[model samples]
Each structure stands twice: as C-alpha cells, then as structure tokens.
Target: MAISIFGLLEVMLLFINAVAILNEERFLAKIGWGRQAANPYEQESVKARIVNLITAVSTLMRIPLIGLNIIVILYLVVLG
Candidate 1:
C-alpha cells in the first residue's frame, strides 16, 4: 500500500540523516571543533559556541528520530 511504501521511504531517509549527523560529528572532530576539545578559551569564541549549539541540537533531534524510525518499522511490519 502507499502508506507502507511511504513508511519505508521515511525509514530510509531517517537512516540517511543519522549517517549524515555522524559524519558531521566526525568532520567537526577532525577540524578541532569537537565536543571533547572544549576549554574555557574555546567557549569564548562566537563561532565555537555556534558550532557547539548546532551539534547539540542535531544530536538531540537524532534521538527522537531514531525512536520514530523504530516505531515506523514496527508499524510497517505489523500492518503493512
């Protein structure tokens, strides 16, 4: 059914988003902007703060997205 197809598509897109987020984190770390390298002086920079904020928001969003993906997969399996 169309609903089932759409659910599958959503799952694929969510998976891609998760991968992209991971890649973003990796890229940030490679560029010396990772969360682990935080220091008092590093926090003073507007650019560093902005990057940290964006990373935090993306990571938070990813949690709910992963849960939604699981729920969608269950729904598709049970009702598709």
Candidate 2:
C-alpha cells in the first residue's frame, strides 16, 4: 500500500521525535535520573524543567509539520 506524501512526512516527524525522546531518556538515565520520582520534589522539578524545554522545542518543530499536513489534506480534498 502506498502512503500519501503527507502521511509519510507525518510519520517521519513522529519517528524523529520518538528517537529524540528515547535518546534523552537514555542520557538522563546515564546521569542517574532513571525515571520520574515522587519522594524528592527537587528531582521531580528537574524532570519537569527538562520536560518543559522539550515541549517548547517540540511545539516549535510541530508547528510547521502541522501546517504542512493541513495544506496537503486540504489540497487532496479539493483536488479529489
């Protein structure tokens, strides 16, 4: 089955983001932050800060991809 260009682009964007998150998690684990916690608020705060940074950058990255997806879907709908 052939995937639409927009669909392929969307998959690629998601794949890249997943890889980045995996890498970030690995790096955090390497630095002793194995995962989220609840005991120490400071640890949770650090994780939250990292999450906020990732979310900010991901939002910027997603804006263009989302715009592209919308444009492509609209084009397909209009042409079809």
Candidate 3:
C-alpha cells in the first residue's frame, strides 16, 4: 500500500513538471510575439493600452499559479 502511494505521488510530480515546462514555454513565446508586435502599434495609442493591459492582467494571474507550484513541489520533496 505504501509503495503504491509513493508511485502515485511520483507520477503526479512528473505530470506537474511537464505542465510547468509547457506553460513556461508558452509564456516565453507570448512575450516574444508581443515584442515583435510592438513596432506595428507604435502609431496606435488605444491599441497599445489594450495590449499592455492584457499582458499585465495575465502576468498578475500567473503569480498565484507560480506560488502554488512552488508549495506543491516543496510538499512533494519533503514529505513524499
């Protein structure tokens, strides 16, 4: 019973790590795309504000996700 539980925990950890890596890659891609898109919007004031606002909001939402991820990793490492 104990061994099965540990096996499950290890699987969960692998899944979480994969998800974190994918999210990081997607985020970096989005930032790169945003940077490339800036030049085209240089003459547009309203569009720039909207784009910046969206980016800011998305970044804010990621804070809790990152924190939770860290906590989960610590829990798995120390207790599992």
C-alpha lDDT values of all predictions: 0.69, 0.59, 0.57
Candidate 3's C-alpha runs over 4 A off are: 1-60
Instruction: Please give the lDDT score at residue 74 for candidate 1.
Output: 97
Candidate 2 — which pairs collide? none
Candidate 2, residues 1-80: lDDT per residue as tens digits? 88888678768766656634544455655765443422355644766666556555555656566666577678769986
Off by over 4 Å in 1: 1-16, 23-25, 29-57
Backbone clash count, each prediction separately: 0, 0, 0
What tens-digit string does per-residue lDDT give for candidate 1 at 1-80?
35666766787767656544765455877876666656668677876785677576676777777777698779779988
Task: Output the lDDT of residue 60, model 2.
Answer: 63
**Higher-scoring candidate on TM-score, 1 or 2:** 1
TM of each candidate vs. truth: 0.40, 0.32, 0.30
lDDT at position 59, candidate 3: 61
Ranking by lDDT: 1, 2, 3
Worst 10 residues of 2 by lDDT: 32-41
Collision count of model 1? 0
Q: How many backbone clashes does candidate 3 have?
A: 0
Error of 3 at 48 (Å): 22
User: Deviation in angstroms for 17 in model 2?
Assistant: 8.4
Q: Alpha-carbon error at 50 in model 3, in Å?
A: 20
Provide the global lDDT of candidate 2 against the true structure: 0.59
Query: Which 10 residues in a row give candidate 3 its minimum summed lDDT?
Result: 16-25
